[model samples]
Target: MRFQIDPNDRKPLGRTGETVPAIGIGTWRINNYSMAETALIRAIEVGMNLIDTAEMYANGEAEKLVGRVCRIIGRDRVFIVTKILPDRFSDQSKVIKALEASLRRLGTSYVDLVLIHWPRPGISIEKQIQFLEATVEAGMARFIGVSNFGVENLSRAIRATKKHEIVANQVKYSVLDKQVEKDLLGFSIENKILIQAYTPLEWGGVAKNETVISIAKKYGKTPIQVALNYLISRPMVMAIPKTERVERVEEFRGSMGWRLGAEDIEILEKI
Candidate 1:
């Protein structure tokens, strides 16, 4: 009910100096098409315009739904991010085609950001980065990044870039998972790369956590809001939590424009 913000509320999107909402919505395992579309429309209306989808999600059904949402809400109002499967990395032409197919599904000529779903074995990181780089040059994507890349691979990927910078790293980061803090977070901060925190609620695992629930009471927020606030409060980090409820998107607004105290952050880190 409190801590509501303007729809234009934004955070630094890496060192590119561009800004995106501190909280974005993720479309991963969405099944109820109509319900999900309504929630996505609410997300964009409330300023969480970055919609993350992949051609692999629900066998490409997610992108089609996102396309419908874009058509309803106007594609320019949404910053769509999509991914190409690692198997497409084998050939430059395949990589281009993968993004082209994604564009077709999304009903857009280009995505705000495109990434490789994951690193494939036997295929060099150099080649994968090159493929992502090609998407940008081809005008299929505005910016390029990687998903699930660790510090070592991320370092190598950034080095492999020839024309553009790796602006973000979409990774599984949440209070339940502190693995990103070990090294990847630091590397991203030092290089000015955005850390897209997916599964920020630990896939609903935080709902009953006493620690998060207790903190939620302190801020008059829900457990889910506490879970997301904890992630976006960090530097160069944004949370892309998936939800199919319009009410849930409303709850997400409280997660921004506020933060936990140092003591609470320390307590959460121990969780």
Candidate 2:
């Protein structure tokens, strides 16, 4: 089925001067190449175009799968994001090499966004940011950001980048994981950086929440849809939820078109 594009579903991808869908597909532990390709193709066919993967996920097989689907669907129609592991960020040369390999596997010359997968101990955040900047300079990535970054890590990255803006910080965020809301969300919004929420479903935990279930019933939606709407309802936030089943992609699409009411949001926040 052809996916309908919801104009209201788009959000700014940090300072990149680009807008992407608030709901995206996350490829983690998708080892079966054929299944990954089919599921991602269906997702893009349904207007969920912000596709996220990592070199660390399935040892780059996920990237390969994303590449295959992007090739089939036309890459320009999607906002592609991938991460470089923390270990590779230790040195500038290693960072470049890893990204080149990622590009090769992705079958794209440039990705919309590339993120530092995590922070490493003893490695200067400034140095890693510098290498990320170099990737953009080299035209390997259009934007650079971090994943699993805290306030201090984000501050260091922003201070370190000389030319480019740290456009996003991918982190675990959901009704169940409010750690980022305590400070990271506020900080990201203040700086015009997008908060790309991974595991927005909390690995299906939100689907079983009593509050989410009741809210879902009120909206004639599933608890998962209620949980996803809650996150994307907030400004400057987007969710990348992962699933191996193509049917779940359709369920995720249901989260769009409507939003949780103010009272429902307040009730969820209390949980």
Candidate 3:
């Protein structure tokens, strides 16, 4: 099936001036390297420009799969993001080495964004932020960000690193888990930090929900499409939904075409 992209849906990610499709593919559970490669190639052919993975995912297997996909499709068209775990920050040398390893795995000279996978417990937040700044200064990543960071932790990290700012905060946000909206979302927006939504569908809730299904019918779209549109339609937000099916890839690309109107947003918000 052919996919459609919206002209205005593409938005700038951060102060870095990089823009990605409002909706893109998330490559976490794509099991086989070859299969991941095929899915990624197909996704890009259908207009998926943003792909997210982490170094710890499958013990770097996911990064290897992403690298293979980039090799087949060429790197320039994809906005690739991979994360460094907090443990690596304890030793600054390891932080740089981990990024080099990720680059080797992805077969890219530099990643678009490198995030701290999580904030370490009882560690000096300043030092962690320093590691991130050092990585950016070393040319290992274009932009620096974080994931799974609470509001207080994110604020601390931001204050600790005066050299650079956290560009995005990847979080678990869905219609079900709206907790992020209560504080994290608002804080990130006010600080100009892009919020990247993971499991934006709540692991298939939107796909099977009666509300989402009904709304999808009204829009002539799939339940997932309606749900994802509701996400990207919001300010300072982007979603990374994982799927390997050909139809789902097309659906994700289609989700970018139209948008959730005010009423649609209200209905989704109430759910």
Candidate 4:
């Protein structure tokens, strides 16, 4: 399917002065590496510019696929985001080496954004933040952020990064999972940080919801589209929904270019 992208269908990437597509592609459990390449390329062709992956995903095979696809698609056309494992954040040297390895696997000199996959217990957030700053200074990554981070961890990460600001916080967010809504969402808005919402479809849970189905019917959209649109409808929010099938990639592209009405949003919110 061919998708026409609207220039206004972009959101600010924190303070990076960059705007990315509100609906992005996520690669996790893309076990079929070959199929992932096709889906990702198709996603980009449909104007999905933000591609999310992690070193831990499929033992780095996902990054390799993304690298290959990005090369084919022209790296400049898309925003690349990947994360480092928390265990590697314990030592600064390990952190640097891990990033270098990730770069090599990704076939790129630098990534647009790098994130701490998760906060390691008993590790100094300040030290890790310092290493992240070093990556920026070394030109290994243009921007740095964290994932699955709570409010306290996010606050500490910001305080620790003396040189750079935490550009985004990637976490599991959906109509069903509003854990971040309790505080993190508000905090992120106040701090000018973007919220990259993963699992916006709630791992397929939303597809079976009666309310979402009704909403989709009313909007003449699929349930998944309704779910993704709801997440990216808010300011400073982006949705990265994953699928290895090329057809599903096209389906995700349908989430943009429109919005949910206030009453519809409230109806879904109550579910």
- Residue 192, candidate 1: C-alpha displacement in angstroms: 0.7
- In angstroms, the error of model 3 at 163 is 2.7
Candidate 4 C-alpha lDDT tens digits along 118-229? 9888888898889788889999999999999999999999999888889999999998887777788878877878899998987899899999999999999999999988
Ranking by TM-score: 1, 4, 2, 3
Which pairs of residues collide in candidate 4? none
Superpose all Cα atoms of candidate 4 onto the true structure and report the RMSD in Å to 1 decimal: 4.2
Clashes of each: 0, 0, 0, 0
TM-score of 4: 0.95
Query: Which lDDT values do the candidates have, in the order given?
Result: 0.87, 0.87, 0.82, 0.86
Q: Model 1 over residues 194-218: C-alpha lDDT tens digits? A: 8899988887898789999999899
Better of 1 and 3 by lDDT: 1
Q: Candidate 3's residue-wise lDDT over 27-132, tens digit each? A: 7766556656677788888777789998998888888888877887889878899999888887899999999999999999999889999898767888888988
- The TM-scores of all predictions, comma-separated, are 0.95, 0.94, 0.93, 0.95
lDDT digits (tens) for residues 128-153 of candidate 2: 89999999999999999999999999
How many Å off is the CA of 178 in candidate 3? 1.1
Worst 10 residues of 3 by lDDT: 1-10
